[model samples]
Target: MPEVFTNELNLFSGQLYMKSMNEYLSVRRFLGLRSADQKDSEPELSGSSTNVMDTETPNLIKFLRVLTMKIRRNCESIDKTHLGRILDHRTLDDSDFANGMDMDM
Candidate 1:
């Protein structure tokens, strides 16, 4: 029915949809579903006798900075669309970011 189709469209057209898509992609990347080019782009871990966190902290920070920039660009792009206007009614909270991190852990 038209109503059913409309409902489905609504379900997938707003901030919730965007969040879900972002989470899915993040999980996939964390699970090593990345492309060859992406693998090449990543910095290699050193085999030096240093703490793992010490070696990885810089890379993690750099990756987060780049990811935040890309997410901002995407949000800007989405804001130009009608769906963005609809989703603008909702606000994001720190919990959203924390939730994503918890999932990764």
Candidate 2:
């Protein structure tokens, strides 16, 4: 309904729909589709469907150098109550960037 009524539809949902359609024939169009090639463009997607987040988690968890520094600074300055909303686990005083997750890395 949101897709039909508004332009502010979730971009990620649209992306996932398109990705699924491209990866699986069941999700693809049965008519009015024109392709110049017999082979599928996404040969990599042939195997069992994988969790999208599993593939993307590594990239999502890492940020650019400057952004990482800003995050660290914010973490250090923020109080425990406020910071707890953003973090899964919290320390009493200084910000814990998760076990073994060094800011330098």
Candidate 3:
């Protein structure tokens, strides 16, 4: 069977980054990266704290925001020619349209 969609969407990349950030923070605290001063500055990173998300969480959030912005910019600048190929009827499938047809009898 022929492929219906030309554009591939990788959604797990975002979730992977979040997972890695959590792992890194766990490793950092496990290795005692937190300092006494930081304990006061970022209570979440304190060894006594229980929050899974700490100071490093904000950095990951910012990175994801920037990534989302870049994706939007890329979409805005997409080459219409390539998109046209994906929109071609030969590439269209039931999933791409309502009820697999454009008109009703």
**lDDT (10s digit) by residue, model 3, range 1-105:** 211111012211321111223433433343224533454456444343232345554464344445533564443322222122221211222333333333211
Q: Count clashing residue pairs per candidate.
A: 0, 0, 0
Cα RMSDs, all models: 15.6, 17.1, 17.7
Off by over 4 Å in 3: 1-52, 72-105
Model 2 deviation from native, Cα RMSD in Å: 17.1
Better model by lDDT, 1 or 2? 1
Error of 1 at 51 (Å): 50
Best candidate, TM-score: 3
TM-score of candidate 3 relative to the true fold: 0.23
Error of 1 at 52 (Å): 45
- Cα deviation at 52, candidate 3, in Å, is 5.1
**Prediction 1 TM-score vs. true:** 0.22
- Model 2 residue pairs with clashes: none
TM-score of each: 0.22, 0.19, 0.23
Better of 1 and 3 by TM-score: 3
Q: Tens digit of lDDT per residue, candidate 2, span 60-80?
A: 323221232355444342222
Global Cα lDDT for candidate 2: 0.26
Ranking of candidates on lDDT, top first: 1, 3, 2
Off by over 4 Å in 2: 1-52, 64-105
